[model samples]
Target: MARPKVPRLSADRIADAAIELIDSGAPFGVNALARSLGVTPSSLYNHIDGRDGIIELVRGRLGRRYLPELPTGTWDEIVVETMQGMRRLYAEHPAIVPLLVGKTITDDAVIESYDVLATALVDGGFPDDEVLSVVAVLDSFALGFGLDYASPDDIWQPGTPTRSLGRLIATAERGDARSDRVFELGLELVLDALRLRLARLRDD
Candidate 1:
């Protein structure tokens, strides 16, 4: 008798199929994906635990490919470079914007990147606890900007302006400027606010 044929299914392969569906701008529910893969919905369980597992796989890929390696320059340089890298990543994987918005960064690759960034912030004078807060702000801003950029409503808008200062001017004229400058300005404002608070702490 011939040996039974084993179904071809793996976490990576399943993730790839899901990503392809996402790329096509189609819904990526388990049933639709199972149909596309020519496998029963239960077959996916052999590869991934469930929908969350598939989402984790996608998030892992997105983080590894998009998160920038820590920069070796000034703290400001590292911050700017990292933010720019994130912006580019979201631009390339627009379909994954929602995932980026609320996804937890539990993947080792993502955690390592966060560690590097957080370490940089600590070295730049932020308290360890504050580093995570700063990271959260930057990540949120980058994701929000990417979503705005990728929206069909803004597809016809002019490209994001290059110069940071020029962004404010471009936005005033109805052009969608890059959010890096705005983010930087916000960071500065936060730093100023922190400094004031710290001063009060020291005075007390």
Candidate 2:
């Protein structure tokens, strides 16, 4: 008896290869993935269903990346932490950002994360009817921030720098710190807005 020279294909391996393509902003082709794995496209079906199945694998991978546990903190604090976590996750996998937001939720890990978020909002004084909307808003913030985080430092450029533009460039030029600063500042502004909403609910 003898073993094959090439490594055997598995679902995770396929998903990993697919992720590499996406993270590099390359086109995704099942045949390409199969070739990369040194296996035939039919072999991929042995461990997973097909293209959609592989996507679910990637989704679950991300869902498992972060703990769905809502930590003990004020609603604003919880939201801030949650948004930051979401941003980091998507930023790490920039290629998947677009795919993730568009796909349906079948993976438990992702669903669990959303459930925790919903629980946080409901307990934080958000109305039941509006919880989903609030969740959607947070999603927008995290997704948008993820894209912004990957952008170049000179997002804003003027031919001749004005005083205000120079100041903007200075702040934006902090390299990695710029992303952190921008995200935190936006989170604070959003939390403040949410506070006003909560107060109005109390008033009613």
Best lDDT among the predictions, by candidate number:
2
Candidate 2 clash pair list: none
The Cα error of candidate 2 at residue 42, in Å, is 1.4
lDDT of 2 by residue, 32-61 (tens): 777777888888878777777778888776
- Number of the predicted model whose TM-score against the real structure is largest: 2
**Given candidate 1, what's the lDDT at residue 166?**
52
Task: Give the per-residue lDDT digits (tens) of candidate 1, residues 1-204.
Answer: 776586487766787788788778898778888988999998877777677777777776766666635466655566666766777777667886675456665667767766777777777677666777878877876666655555442333446655565554444423245444455576577556656755675577
Residue 114's lDDT within candidate 2 is 79
lDDT of 2 at 189: 89
Against the true structure, candidate 1 has what lDDT? Answer: 0.68
Model 1: runs farther than 4 Å from truth?
1-7, 68-73, 151-204
lDDT of 2: 0.78
Q: Return the TM-score for each candidate structure.
A: 0.67, 0.85
